[model samples]
Structures are given as structure tokens and as C-alpha cells.
Target: MHLAFLRDYHEALVIALARTRPTIERGTVAEITSLTPQAVSKVLTRLLDDGVIATAGVRRAALGKPAAVYRLVPESRWAIGAHVTRRALRLVLTDLAGTVHASATTALPADFTPDDLLGRLDSGVTAMIREHRLDDDGPRPLIGVGIGMVGPLDQATGTVRDAHRLRHWHDIPLAELAGQRLGRPVLVDKDVTAAVTAEAWRRDAGFRDAALIMVESGVGAGLWLNGAAHRGTHTNAGEFGHTVIQLDGPACACGRRGCLEAVHDRAADPAAAAAILGVGVVNLLQTLDLGHIVLAGADLLRHGEIYRQVVEDAVRTQVPRADWLTAEVTLTGLGTDVIAAGAAIQVLNLRYGLPDPVGLRLP
Candidate 1:
């Protein structure tokens, strides 16, 4: 590895620690990151000088010299995340620590077009910036914008290859278009991927090998494996809704018959729908051997407890040797804000979080 890249990784690791840990010090950070004391000292000094972190006073040890504690200066930078749902656009402004400081939502037109979305995005983002008084020239400037939209889209090129159920979205260059309109750097990703990223950020190292199942306008699963968001070969991984569950089932928007989403959506009641969802989740667990399953999305949250119970029951009863193949299931604590907040956190991750270890194998 290049020395410069290694230095960048060390800095990102330290920043990640400061974001998640309540208190940070040289000894603990070095211990956790496996960086030598001297390297840790250099990283800390640089971060401190850059105003990304600040001293939180001192921690005294009876045997050794008192070590200075540090904490992330969350307000030093900010990013806006937008969740582009079928009915509305949900926006959240988050800080470097990934804490959502403010949120807003605006309704979209029926079967909205790229122009429609771009217009709304421009007005909405401008309003947010003005309302929050987030001066571009201020000490704490807004970093960028991130959009979490329904997908089967291309994350690598920031283009929508073909967003299921939305006609105008095909072949749209969302990231570039939004960036041009908003006058800020932009990132576009599947909504489920964004939601899972938010959960991973919140859970820290404990979030390894997990999936975030979302059920709003449709069903999809966001995958986080080996400590990172798994955006498969085409960067279009989270199309969990279209997975075939029934051979003679109803037709789906993706031109598939008996897809999980189609079957679940046709169910009579919330309980029935949830039960259908549970089966798919168990299938996911069986395939991935996931340790955590987080449930989110507005439609699902309306009957959150019912879905949670159904999914938990499925996990307990369906998978073989349930005792050994246990998976914790729960609703996303962020409620409807999960995807939007995750979008903003994605921007933070790009700017100040850990570098992706793409080809490295993990234990």
C-alpha cells in the first residue's frame, strides 16, 4: 500500500472512532486501530489542527500521565440527504457525527419526471440552506448532497438504469444533474443501501454482516457485509423486491411473476403482508447468514410492531438450528428518517469517514 493511502486510512479510522465513541484518547485509539503511538499522535495532531476534532479535557490515570481526551466537532461540517420516495422527498441535514439536526419533506407529483424532481430538489435544497442559514463561506459549511432513490440504478455512474415502477427515471444521470442544480457535490444510491449505511454508522463495529429490509412503495433489501455496504457487481444489488418467491404468483412491475413484493403487496391485511415479508427475510438470512436484520420504510412502520413480531417469529421458527443461526430483528430506530439520514451520512462518509477496503479479505 502507498504510504499516503495508509496515512489517509489512519486519519479516517481515528475520525470514525471519534464519531462513534463518546470519548477518545491517544492510547485507546491506538489500541483499537492497531497504529503505533507515534502514528496515532501524528493523526490526532493533524485532525486537531484541521478542527475536525477538539479536546474534551483530560483523562487522568493513577499510574501514568494524564492523557487528553478528544471528541468530534460534529458541527464543523454538514451534509444534506434526500430520500426520493414515490409520494414525497424527505430531506435531512446531518453533521460530521451523523446526527440529524433538521429535516423537511415535500410532496412530489404523480409519476414525476426528472425535470419535476430536479425543480423540487432545487427549491427544497435552497430553502433548507437559507432556513438553516448554512453559509457556504462560514466556518461550518455544508459539505454536499446525497440522494437515496428507488433503484435497480447504477451507483458507479450515478445513473438510473431503470428504476422499477417509475418511467421517467430510466437512464437519468441523477447525481450529476442534482449536483449541477444544487451547486454541491452529489451522490446517488439505492434507498435501501442508504438506509443500511445509516444503521451501520449507528451500530459501529457491531453492525457487521447485516441487511436492512425496507417496505415503502415497494420491497427491497440493503446489504452490509464484512463491515461495508455491498453494492454488487453492477452496483445495483438491492433489488430484493423482485426475487421470485412463487412460480404461479401475480405479475410484478419488473415483469416478473410471483416476486416477493408482488405477493406481499397483494395480501389482504397488514398481518398477512408482514407474514409474506417474513418468509422472504428468512430466505435472505439462510442465504447470507446475517447477524442483524433491521426493518424500515414508511409503509412498514405504520404497522411496525406487527411486522417486527412476524419477522422475529419467522427468524426463530424457520431457519434450521435456530439456536445456532440466531439473528436479531428490530425496526429501524430512525423511523421514516432512516433513508434520508443515511443519505446525508453517506456524504459524511465520503468526506470524513473510513476508506473502503474493497479487495481486502476480512476475518
Candidate 2:
């Protein structure tokens, strides 16, 4: 079982490498992964047999025999992801390569309940499967559905434990319920965490230690630390909005006085709101020392330039040493599609991507 697990991890590692590059060769894969050539050869053979990768001719080096090349068969797997906001359910279809192929949105009733969400989720996944011709028995099959939702939730149990501002969501076993309703496997995670996963997926390894600051109906930060999603001990790491920036500020939806979100929302104009958000961002920088700060969410994107500039300025000017503590601030590349697309990618990652390198310490 241990050897089998190792083999699977190696395959996943190779697949992850293939996803980042256009093509991969045996020697290069072995070198990059620190695996023996024989092991890499065996893994390559298995991947070829499984149709996860395909040979792409051979590379001829001047000193040695030609090395076989392989590339990821991205269309070999598909996943559907849904972003459940307070007012809407946004769904997207993504391939194994994390590309969004199609998207659909349906507005929910004001302060929607779990059942209302499940109904829309059921219909949305079904419609996407039908429209995209995602057959379960076909060569390229739909893997599962992923949900990026509002938080104060437990990702480990896939349950929503009273999402902030949403009255109907307390101890809702969303993944299980959605899986039962849709007749497919489901994975649920906080929206900000999922959004950061999308950014990390697209940006590759260099995106280590970053924060995705979301300013949608409320505020939150999705943490990507050491190249993976950091959900904290209880899986409720991102409550950036509730952090008190002022001791005597306005009362927030979270029932806190002087919270970042409340102050930002209460600001007179977009510029003032952005400046408030910037201060919160600087505070985050002081704590996390993130290399990248991605501004996302509908509200922020509406005034993207202002938010981007204010945050950038704050990072450059506020963090002690301007020259040494440099950080890049920008808007999300995926735009509104980020969270949903990320959710879909999470499903793909669960199946085809690299497994977490934890708990197993090999000699």
C-alpha cells in the first residue's frame, strides 16, 4: 500500500509538471522530480496507458539517445464549479487544464435557503453536463462538482456553519446534500480560499505566499501560503472584514464595531473606501509578508483601478522598508469567473492533480 501510494504521488507530480509545461521528457521529469530514470519511465508508461498523457515525439540530445516527450491530455477530464453568493449561484465548466469553457448564472431569492441553492445547483450542473456533452462513460468524463461558498464554514466536513449575513445557512452539510441531489460527488470550500486556488493554479509555483483580497458583498482574504491554500485550524481562516481597524468605528454585519468591512463600506466615495481597504491590506502584509496581493470580487472590480492603486500605494509606503518589503498588487486575471473556475479546478485537483505532500516522510 505504501509503494502504491508513492507510485500514485509520482504520477500526480508528473501530471502536475505536464500541466505547467507544453511538453515533458523522461530525463527532465526525473531530474526535476528527483525520481530515478527507471521510476520516471514506469510512471510515463502508466500515464500513457491510462490516457492521461500522450507521447509528443522524441527529443534528440547530441550526447545521448532520443528522449520520449509527453503532454497532458487536458480534455480527458472535466469538472463543474459553482460560486454561491448571497444573491446568485454562478456555475462554470472547466477542463483538466483549468480553462473555463462555459458559464451560467441564476439569481437566487433574497436571503435564499439551502434547498433553494440545492435546486439551482442541481439544475445548473445538469444543464452544463447536457450542453457540454459530458458523459460519465465517455473518454473525457465529468469528474465532479465543486462549490465555492460564503464562509464561517468548515471545509473539512464540507459544511456551512452559519455563513455571515446569510440567515438560512447554519450547519448545512452542503457537499453531501449537493452530492445526493445531483447524483455526483461534491467538494465545498470557502469562496476566498477557492478563488486563491484558481490564482495559484494559473500562476504556477511562483505564486507562493499570496493573499486574494475579496470585496464582494462583504470582505475576506483567501490565503495561499507556501504554495497551498491555508484554511487555518478550523477552516475559517479568511475573516478579513471582521478585523477591527478602528476601536470606535461603525458596527459591522458581523456585529463588531470598527471592523474593516464596515469602515470601508461606510466611506463616502470609492476613493475613501479603497483607502480603507488599503489599510486593511497593509495590516495583512505586516502579518503574512505575501509576495502577491490579488484584488478580486464584484464590488472591488467595479472600481478596480482605484482599489489597485490605493492598495499598491499602501503596500509600498506603509510596510516599514519600502525598498526591501516589496509586494506586487494587481487585479485577478480570471475576473468574475475566478471563484467558480477555482472550484472546478479543485475537483480536478482532487482527482488528477498532485496530492498533498504531508504525513508521509519517506526515507
Candidate 3:
């Protein structure tokens, strides 16, 4: 086994425990990680030396020697997340503990290009750094940037693959461009996916299988399946709006007939729109059997209660055996800031999150 891999895995495990619990002792970490006390001691020493965790004095007991306690240093690192929508760009600064410290939003010109977004981001990030007085030379330094945008984009390659209704975004290497402009690492993901990540981060363990249904300028679903963001093989899975609802009903922006978005967009009123969206939600429930459905996005949130009730009622009545297979429907707790905050959380997760067990190589 590579010593580096062991170190990272152990460090991530301890950091995760420290974030949730009030304090962590070497023995408790050993018990949880199944690592020997000696191994846990080595990991703790490294984490303390790196300033990722801090000694929280000692916990004395009636038993053996007093064990040293440790806690996550939330401000030990920072990240900036940006939510790019058709109308505006929202940014948030988050600490290692995934707390949003500050946020700001800027308007975007209609049909903006890749360059347009990069300019706004460059200025906005510079302003945020200055405003917050985040020290680059400090023990806790700014990490990198994460961008969540409307998609049909490739998260792996950070390429925008023709975002519906946005003409200038065709096959743009946004992550590379933005990274060059901002002079920092960048991560790009679907807006809804990022929003769902934020929801998962804030909620407890029960939020494993869920979907964040967003209806801003368009409709999309962010899937959290089996405790992770379920980006499809192509990283374009959350194109919920384009799912055909009515065969030969109406033409859609993706050049399809009878899309859910087209019908909802053409609805006579918010009630009718909510009804259309409710049908889509039921379809998703039947397919995924999700435990939670979160409604978000500016357009949907304008009539948040109406949409929430419609989805909740649909899940209650439309799904067979609804009484037994209950699905919780609610609005996003973070409101409009969900995507940006989630993007920031992604950056934090890159550094401190646990390694995927499925991907880990066993000797």
C-alpha cells in the first residue's frame, strides 16, 4: 500500500469525524476507523502538524491515561463557489467545516458568452477576497473555486455541451478558461447537482437517495443516489426538463416535441405549471423511489409553497402504496444560495472528504 494513500484516507476519516462530533480522541478515531491506536496516533500527529486539526486539550477519565482530544479547524482552509444561471452569477465563500461565511451575486447579460462569465468571476472573486480580508499568507488559506452552471455539460472534462437556450456556451472548456482567468483550480458541475450536494451536506445520513428538482429558467433534477451525486456516464443526467411528457404536444428548446419544460413553460398559470411539474415528480418517484424530493430554483421558489404542496400532494396520492412508501417533499433550506454554497462544499470535499470505498484498491 502506498503510504500517501493511507495518510490521505486516515486524515480524511479523522477530519470527517471531527467536523460532526464536538471533539475526537485518538481512541475514538481508532474505534471508528478500525485503525490501531498507533496508526491513529500517526494520523493525528500529521493532521495537527498540517493545521487541519487542533489539539483540544485532554480528556481525563477514571480509566487509563488521559486521551488527547482534537477538533477540526474550520477556518484552516477556504473555497469560493459560483452558481451561474441565465440571469445572474452567485458566489459564496465557505470554510473547511462547510459553513458559508460570505456571499454575493452579480447580474449577467442576456445570452452571455464564456468570456463574459470569466470577466464577471474574475472581478467578483477579487472583490470577495478583498472584502473578507482572507489572508493568502495565513495558516488557513483560500483553496480554489467551484462553478455550478446550467448543464448538459461534462463535469469530468469541465466542458459545457450546449446548455439549453444558451447559444454561446456550446462545447466551451469553461473550467480551463476560468482557471486561467482566476489563477486557481476550478471545478464545474451541473447547477442542480451542486444544489443537491449542498442539501446532502446539510442534512443527516437519511438524505442518501434524494433528488433536487430545480425550476429556474429551466427544469432539472439533481440526483443523490446511494449517498453520492449520481452524475451519469456522460455527466449530463439531470436534463429533467427534456424528458418527454406529452408525445407530439409542443416543440422544446432541445428540438423535441412535448417536453415537460415546454408544457410547463406554456402553462396558463402557476397552478397549471405546478400541476405539470407534479406529474414529472410522480414519474421520477416511480422510476427512482427517492426518499426526498427538494424543490428549488428562482422560478420555482417564486411560488415555492404552491410548487411544494403540489409535489407533496402528488407523491401522497399519485404513487401507489404512498402511505407505506412515503417521500418527503420540501423546498431547499438554503433557498437561492444552495448551488453556490454546494459548489464551495465540493471544493472542501475534494480536500477533506472520505475516499470512496468502492474506488479504493485493496491489497
TM-score of each: 0.96, 0.95, 0.90
Q: What's the C-alpha lDDT at position 258 in model 3?
A: 97
Candidate 3 ranges with C-alpha deviation above 4 Å: 57-68, 135-137, 356-363
Q: What is the number of residue pairs that collide in model 1?
A: 0
Choose 2 or 3, whichever is better by lDDT.
2
Write model 3 residue lDDT over 8-53, tens digit each, in one string. 9888878878877779998888998899999999889998888888
Reference-based lDDT, each prediction: 0.89, 0.88, 0.87
Which scores higher on TM-score, 1 or 2? 1
Is candidate 1 or 3 superior in TM-score? 1
Q: Pick the candidate with the highest TM-score.
A: 1
Candidate 1 residue-wise lDDT, 98-189, digit = tens: 78899999999988999999999899889999888887758868888899998878888789888777878889988889888887778888
Better of 1 and 3 by lDDT: 1
TM-score between model 2 and native = 0.95
Decoy 3 TM-score against native: 0.90
The global Cα lDDT (0 to 1) of model 1 is 0.89
Off by over 4 Å in 2: 357-363
Which pairs clash inside model 3? none
